[model samples]
Target: MYRSLLLGLAGNSAAEALALRYGMRLGASRFVAGTTLGEALAAVKALNGKGIAVTLDHLGEGIRHLDEADGYMGAYLSLLQAMNREAVNGNVSLKPTQMGLALDPVSALDRIRAIVREAELHSLFVRLDMENSPYTTATIELVRQLHREGFSRVGTVIQAYLYRSAVDVKRLTVERINLRLVKGAYKESSSIAFAKRDDVDSNFKRLIKIRLDSGVYTGIATHDETIIDWTRSYAHRRSIPRSAYEFQMLYGIRTPLQESLAREGYTVRCYVPYGERWYPYFVRRLAERPANAAFVLRNMGRRE
Candidate 1:
């Protein structure tokens, strides 16, 4: 129930406004790097210093106008340029809706294409983050379009909680498109997603095995230690080299675990998010784990 409440608040505009007014003082700073690209880059540098890679996310979505999409496109272009100029060991991640997918799919595709083109020039990978069920098909199709147009440096995420992910994973792997497998953070209907944690974890393991066996590079994005251990054991049993896959985790959720994996000579990447539109992302992070919400409430009385 607590998780559902936080997920519900993720789409509440009034709650978003109140959270924005309070800014990072409400404890969003723990998850969100900051509201600017510069801050995000700095965080990336720090993570890189620790032998961990990063995927920078400029947090904004559900735009109400095409102009906002243009602005986001420009910001992403600038972000790509900055990462290259700074020589950071990181790539970029973006939501399809943030590029106007919700308003017009065609326009959103053009915007995303431009960003992918820019990224290709820098030899950087761009990840199309999967939002909710409503946009899943469109997001995957957009990646397909980009791939067909010769933008091979692009890929999209897959949510294990979804029933359709197994098919999506197989097809995309056959296409040789790199993927980041996440357990999923958004609240999805039980009809389309696995409601029980055990089921989700089981499916997550199944998807991981599928990708690992395919011999294609995959990003196993999860914070579960048990899953991590299982992945290590399975990969060892299969003799899959560490270079074939990387472990991914959120920026603030599990610092020690991330660094520990890195120390073990395994590739670890952190999904670092920034930008002013952080309320939604922040709420989703809380929804993923009750401990996160408790941390926020415990610190709500403290000054930032």
Candidate 2:
């Protein structure tokens, strides 16, 4: 119930405005990296020092203008430059709409191709983040397009909640592409997505096993202990090398587990999102876990 409410409000302009005006003051910093690139880089460096790899995301989505998308492209270019210069141990993940998919798919493709080219130059990887259902097909096409063009460092995500994901995974596996398997966050409809948590979890585990067995580099993106243990046990039983797959978690969602995984000789990457347009992203994070809602609300009331 809370997840649906929060997701609805993610698209509410008035709610976004109010939240953006007060989110930092209301303790959003705990989840968000920071508003500036430098701050985010600092966080990246700190995490790297702890033996954790990173995938940086400069957050903004639902863009509608060409110039706005161009600006985000510039931001990513600058971010890539910084990552190379500062020796930051991380790559990047980006949203298609932030590159102008909503305005024009051709223009969006051109922009993303440029970014992928830049990543290739820097020997960095780019993960095209999966958004809500509307862009799912387009995102997959973008990944395939990049791959066909010889940009091997590019990849995309798959959401387990979607009914079509099993087929999608099977199709993608044929290409031997890198994939991040997530349980999904957006509030999708019952017609297209599994309405029950157990169903989603089951699909997620199944997808992970398929991807792992196929010899593709799979990112097991989850914070669930049961899933984590299952992944570890399955990989161990099958004699899969630790380098064959990695575990991923959001930046602030599971720090201890991330560190523990790293210490245990597993490659763990933290999805670190940073930028001023953090209201929507932060809200979704809260909705993904109800306990986050209570913690944030209690802190907000205490501050009051």
Candidate 3:
């Protein structure tokens, strides 16, 4: 119930505005790295030193203007350059809406194509983040287009909650594109998404197996220990190399688990999100785990 409520609030514009006003004081600092690129890069460097790879995300979405989209693209380009210069072991993940997919898809595609090419120059990968159902088809299609255009380093995510995901995974497998599987965080409709944890988990495991067997590099992005252990076991039984797939978790949510997996010789990537506009992303993180929410509640009365 609490998770559902927090997920619902993730889309509340008023709540987002209020939360932004309070900024880091809202206890977002625990989840969000910081509000600047430098802070985020520092965090990335620390993770890199610890043998953990990183996927840098500049957190803002639901863009409305071409200028806003252009800025995001520029920011990503700069980020990619910085990573190369700093020798950080990381790539990037971005939302299509943040690139103006809703306002003008052609523009968004152009922006993403440019970023993908830039990443190519830097020898990095780009992952297109899947938003809610409204953007699912578009996100998948965009990745397909990129692949056809020879941007093989490009990839995207699939949320297990959506019923269409199984099919989407198969279709994407044909393209031979890399993918990240996530248990979705969006507030989705019962008609379209699984409503129970058991259903989601079951589907998640199914998707993981499908992707693993598909013979592509897959990212299993889950904090659930059961899923993590199962993935480890499944890969071992199949004699899959550690390079065949990697484990991913959010930046601050499960530090110890991430490190342990890395120590165990698993390729682990941390989703490091940083930017001033972190309200929506932070709230979604809260919705994913009750313990994170409780931590925030305990510190609510205290100043950031």
Tens digits of per-residue lDDT, candidate 2, 84-138, equal: 9999888999999999997899999999999989988999999999999999999
Which runs in model 1 stand beyond 4 Å of their true positions? none
Q: Best by lDDT, which number?
A: 1
What TM-score, over all chains together, does every model reach? Answer: 0.98, 0.98, 0.97
Once fitted onto the true fold, the runs of candidate 2 whose alpha carbons sit more than 4 angstroms away are none
lDDT per residue as tens, model 1, 1-304: 9999889998898998988987588788899999998899889999999999999999999999999999999999999999999998989999999999999999999999999999999999999999999999999999999999989999999999999999999999999899999998888889999999899999999999999999989999999999999999999999999999999999898999999999999999999999999999999988888899888888876855
Which wins on TM-score, candidate 2 or candidate 3?
Answer: 2
TM-score of 1: 0.98
Error of 3 at 30 (Å): 1.2
Q: Which TM-score value belongs to model 3?
A: 0.97
The all-Cα superposition gives candidate 1 an RMSD in Å to the true structure of 1.0
